[model samples]
Target: MTRCRAWLYTIICFALAGLVTGCWDGVELQRRAVVLMMAIDPAPDHPDWVVVSVQIARPQRAQPPSTGGSGSTSGGNKEDRPIAVVSREGRDVAEALQTIQLAINRVLFFGHLQALVIHEQVARRGLAAVLNPVAQSRVVRRQIWMFVSRERAEQVVNALPVLDVIPGMHFTNLFRNQIILRRQYDATIGGFRQRLVTPGVEPYLLGIDGMDPRLSAPRIVGLAVFADDRLVGWLPGDDYVGWALADSQFPRLDLTIPCPHGHGQFVVNVTRVRSRLRVMNPDAPRPKAVLHVHVHGMIEGGPCVQKEREADIQVLSRQVQQVLAKIIGQSIQKAQHLGTDVFGIGRQVYRMHPSAWHGDAAWRQTFPRLRVIVQVTTRLDYMQTYRQSALLYVDHEG
Candidate 1:
């Protein structure tokens, strides 16, 4: 009986402890101003300083049912409450953020930050000064998306979309949309910082800019290439497409390539892209990189000669393969010219032959001289009934 009673008491104690479980230092949600996004730009008139801007979400209070409200549309003055974007200048990101905290009424909360925007000038200067402080933060999540804006980071954080008023939702929508479309490159802080410490492979981020001068909306496009922690150059449309395709980031990409006959243009909606980059003779004075990309897509649309029987898709596939090789090859060359190894070819060399791989300085020296051979295999899942157009084909013309 004594033993049974002791066990019962212990069980009761455990039950009480379970009931007492709660955050010991929890703060009420209303007391904290949630930061939606943050931006870093060069401070005006302070070449050595950085301006950090954070967009804080304004929470609307629920009002009681309008007492005999005369068909009023808005719930209240809620629409007037804009996402408060405030900036503070300091020697570095952490100091700037600390200053902002002192000025704000509520404690600045970053547990739910959506994005981090860095200006073009800031990127060119180098990201180490800005990112080091951010990486040290305990609350800031690394999975949040990162972008480099061509415009001032201030403009990106301040601009409000008429269609989407929920602060930072436009960025979220654009980012996720790109993923869904499988057309553009995307970057997250966690992945990028990992590459910072990673061997051989450099880092890249998605870019944002006012694609049109007339529009206030920011468009996500292209890529910001970085050599180690410093921004080197950017890859434009075609180059970005090539990088995305070769890096296995794009599951679907639409391409308009010349027909096999080389006279007219045709289209193919490419999908299931897979790329493998291999480095041969890593120990030699100069190494060779062979990039093999295998893709499967359908002949989407284009000017094609309607053959009496189904056209030869093998020829069409071969043409597509060549075109892809050219596209990917050009992108690789651009990266080499920029002196940034955007492709993980260097990483492969290090992994395949660790002893052969020297330090970064040695690798960078060999990279530009390295010749990359791009081989693409395009398989048409199925072709349309149409094929070669004799009238459109110019066998004898350039």
Candidate 2:
């Protein structure tokens, strides 16, 4: 009898729990505006004020058919845009967002935010103040891609994406695909914050440039070097290419090696690359860092200057290694000149020799003067399809 009474009590509790489990604190999706991309720019007139622009995805509603016999719909077409951009200014990011909320009828939600873009001017000034509110906000996710735009941040945010209906999605896909296909660096807000506060290392953001001035199509160009939290300068063109080779997590790169015969360049499609950095003599006034890079690739296309002999392939490999070492050396020099440790060499030093790290202050002073040595080893394992170039045979007969 006691057991039966206990079971009845449990049943009653379960029924009451179900009654209270409905959407008590839920907002309707249609009534809320979802922010997909956000941009922060310093106000031209007032340096104290910051202009924030947001690209909000508008709800898509089906359009009714045309009244006339024409097949086209009245309200919907391929030309219709699925997003709306709004801008507001305030002393801080939070205040600016609040002002935007007051102007719009719907509540603004950042849970869907995909990208964060800052104008070059704003980035050069500093990101601490701008990123503070965003880092603290529960709605903003840490994984969003961050960029420093050469053009106004608003222009990148407002630019229409050609491939996708939503601009933010396009940007996300573009960055992710580039990392896989081109082996570019991946920079996110979370990674940036950790690097900013962590000792022995600094942070960087991908530099974006407007490809077409009229269309305002933005493209990832290079990297923006930051000393502490302030942007120092840019790593452009081949300069960035060198950095990417050293720092990429998955290094698949392309190299144009000058032919040994001095005719033209051959393309080497590097499928795999690995980099290892070692610190020597940490107690010395100037510590030395040795970076060893191992690369394995195949010759894609070039004038076939080499005979089919194994000796010829070995010689070609040595030439490729020399070129790669020179490129990596140049990249390291550029970072050293900027007085920024983009390679995280200081972090390696801290881990290997903790006694050497006095603190953040001491590491910064030592990093600029430190010596770096780059060594590259390359192997051409196979000559795809062709054993020897047709040109080699033609030249032999001549």
Best by lDDT: 2
- Per-residue lDDT of 158-233 in model 1, one digit per residue for the tens? 7655445564776677677664225222378888878877788888888887633222356877889998888899
| Backbone-clash count (model 1) | 0
Error of 1 at 226 (Å): 0.6
Which window of ten consecutive residues has the lowest lDDT sum in model 2?
389-398
Candidate closest to the true structure, highest TM-score? 2
Give the Cα-based TM-score of candidate 1 against the true structure.
0.84
- Model 2 lDDT per residue over 1-398, tens place: 99999999999999999889687767898889999999999988888788999988865722222333442223334345567889999987889999999999988888889989998988988998889878787878888889999988898887765445667887788777665324222378888888898777789888898755332357778889899899998988767777777774445667899987788888888888778888888668877888877777787767854554676776677677777777777777888888788888888878888987787667777777777777676667554432222111000000
How far is 266's C-alpha from truth in model 1 (Å)?
2.3
Off by over 4 Å in 2: 2-8, 11-24, 61-79, 180-186, 212-216, 248-250, 304-306, 384-398
TM-score of each model, paired residue for residue = 0.84, 0.86
Residue 311 error, candidate 1, Å: 5.0
